[model samples]
Target: MKWLLACIAPVLLAAWILFLSAHGPASWVLLPGILIGIACAAGLSFLRSFSPALRALSLTLYLLPLGLLSTYRASAFSVSKDFELGALPLASAPSEMSIAQLPTGVTYRSAAFGYRGGSLFEPRVFSMTAILIKHPKGDLLIDAGFGRDIAQHLATLPLPFQLLTRYTLNKTAREQLQSSGYDLTRLRAIILTHSHWDHISGAADFPEVPVWIPPAERSFVQGEDVTTATARSIKSLHIEEYRFDARPYLGFAESHDVYGDGAVVIVPAPGHTPGSVIVFVTLADHKRYAFIGDLAWQLEGVTEQEERPLTQRIADFEPRLVREHLAHMAAISARYPELTLVVAHDPRSFASIPKWP
Candidate 1:
């Protein structure tokens, strides 16, 4: 009876946590349940009737799932082979064209949260950054980042997300632009990589500026999906929907060249969301960047081809589509070593871009 009790407690504990991770309610609600399991397991040590060997086995069983969850590798998907990408398109970027990064805030998390094989002890700072693309025609903001009303924005999220997420806000993208004495008139649109709250929150601050998105994303924002709750809550957004022409830029089947000069091209890579995109920006110096939004949370998603852990199913709308796009991007990175692939949440990916003064 003693051996059976010792063995069963840790096994039950691991199974309970795994079940909650997948199907539990809010993260806060999960805490009490998990703590109770821990307390029960800890209490079992007082059973001196169990042999020392039995106690050792119980401890090992309790920790095995945690170790696997943190470091288990997922099978990698293959890159698209049917599509052939020819020579890079010539970009007629204006001499005055430039780009900058506006870091609004960061969320502290373990590397394990971003991708599989990442260490739980290793801390990763997820950047809530927006990009500014200055053009002779009109300037564009890649994403909104955090906003002045971030507290309200956060409150709109699911309670589980709110409980698990810890963030620190700096200046919003709107505040940064205004403080820099930027000409608001030159701003054409806030081109969203996706309509997720973290990317669209600051757009509320610029009610007058139009928010450009692909048609699919417009539907997502207008739909009843819980993911776009924050975006739907912001009634002031001026939405301008656009479509993609059947022009293959890189391996992508369809592309929308925003500037018509091969300088700023938008390509659909909708796995993270129904309308997620990869924005390709070419500068006057011919430096190129591909701002991939949440396809992978970190550089390793492209470089090493690591996908998010299975437990983080909530992070992706369609995991299969994400893997397809990720494999596609990974192939592009390999073919064009000079082009920089910027993952939205990876701060290190923005090191080359200058920060807004």
Candidate 2:
């Protein structure tokens, strides 16, 4: 019983706290439920001690279903396609432009956490990428990789898995930009799709560049400790609230035009997070790319249409809402064939693009 409590209590407590924090639920209601649950769990484990095999079976029954529930709930927003379709015509690789890739860092993770059928025997290795847009006006960084300080801070967070196992911040965005001959201070602006730590950790590096963030993201950041601080600290940053606009590249959607040109546009793509926006860039050559942050964490999410496993999905009190949004994103992507979608964490997409530095 003690061993069971030691194992299950921490996981449940962490999950519960994260749940409460994500949703502003009344703590009074949750506290008693958690306590009762813990008691019931411990009591049941004590009773099953007489049969070790039964205890193990009970544990598996309890956890496996919970994992499935979490995964389905987390993917409630994910879109399901009944038939397999070939790649769209516009989705073809660009023929005119040169592409480069910069490795931000390597994320380490258990095989169970990565691909759709990742097994303990098949360990998964992944890397984070930042694709640089070498524009005529200036260089635009798609996803800002972590700075030195923020990377170290994340290394110490009380997460079940090491961030380094999932992401590596090998080259800071600022350093890469500078080394590539682009002045850090002269950067035009940064468009962020969401406020996940991995996406926004480099915000501190470019203090003065105007950051264009989706309206919903601004609200989401208020609930997170580190990100809220980073959001508040970004100097000269511009919060682009959700607005109905009629622009050339943006068409009619909730979006913000950074330079009022068709060059860079921030469009709301809110399933990954409340305020998640897709940074759409039309290169000088007229090729378009959409940087969808965490909308799809892995390339297989796009190619194979595999939703994240239940154990790894975010639990924001009401898991159904999050799942529904993810499904919506998949549906939208399926409908749009004109834009090349870029998932922020997918190293393959990043590798296919040009690196800034």
Candidate 3:
């Protein structure tokens, strides 16, 4: 046991140093990784004391270079910079004002599935979706894609989830929003569907914009589930929480009117996470667009009725009132053919929408 500790102590120390150097002392993003690594080292060392085979297997597992190959293969795809920045193929352009979908930034498919039981072989893959919305008032970003640093972080560590290597922030969503004629200073507000790392990475990009977060998600972001740096970052933002109100949009429950004029509506759709939400945008001509974040990985979840199994879904994440709110969205989408539902992280759906400036 002592020998094993001596061998792993250096590796752990090096990881800690690297983490601090990259993000500073405030960076606690890798806390989970550090905890898991230490636990594994301790458990394996104890086991090695009893069995030589266990010791050999532990050493071999740590030495394996498969994680690097996985990261490389995952990051192979490139995001398209030149997406058609206009309306959908079927929708007619509004004659009053130009309503276009702009790709503020692009995201790539990461290995789906978040950490579970500390096993890399687990077949779970969480979807990574990002969107940029350009309104006459100002440019609004739905969710920020995973930053480059996160991909690099995942590559070296044996995290259970896939790293989004292919997706690069070709231009920060902030830049795209600015080019689209939206001033960050005047930027009315930024709404996060949830506080997951992928969705909130770009929050730093819009520090000035008042962020609207779900009340349920407040605890998660403020709690130990997130890194101290991340929590602090979230705390620094101007955050407002909305009670689930299923009154607006005709049967959709639990939403906050971002602009008050009904231009953008933030709806609570919890299942994937406690504070999962959907952003609803109403164009000049009263056309509606729903930015549903991670309700389903692909559009198929909403389109083909293929959602995660009931057992796998988060039940206590959102209160019963919030769950009913999600049902309202489903029902409204079914009834309103004109209302466009945007699924965050789906490449096909993102491709179908017009890119932002």
Instruction: State which candidate, 1 or 3, has the greater TM-score.
Output: 1
Global lDDT scores for all candidate models: 0.82, 0.53, 0.51
Per-residue lDDT of candidate 2, residues 232-259 (tens digit): 5444345545453643233313456654
Q: Write the per-residue lDDT of candidate 3 for residues 182-283, one digit (tens) a residue.
A: 656645556787776566666666667666677777766676552223434444466767666655445443557654566667766665666777777776
lDDT of 3: 0.51
Q: Is candidate 1 or candidate 3 better by lDDT?
A: 1
The candidate maximizing TM-score is 1
Q: What's the TM-score of every candidate structure? A: 0.84, 0.65, 0.57
For residues 104-193, write the lDDT of model 1, one tens digit per residue.
998876666677666544568889999999999899999989999888998988886776667899999988989999988899999999
Ranked candidates, highest TM-score first: 1, 2, 3
Worst 10 residues of 2 by lDDT: 84-93
Candidate 1 scores a C-alpha RMSD against the true structure in Å of 5.7
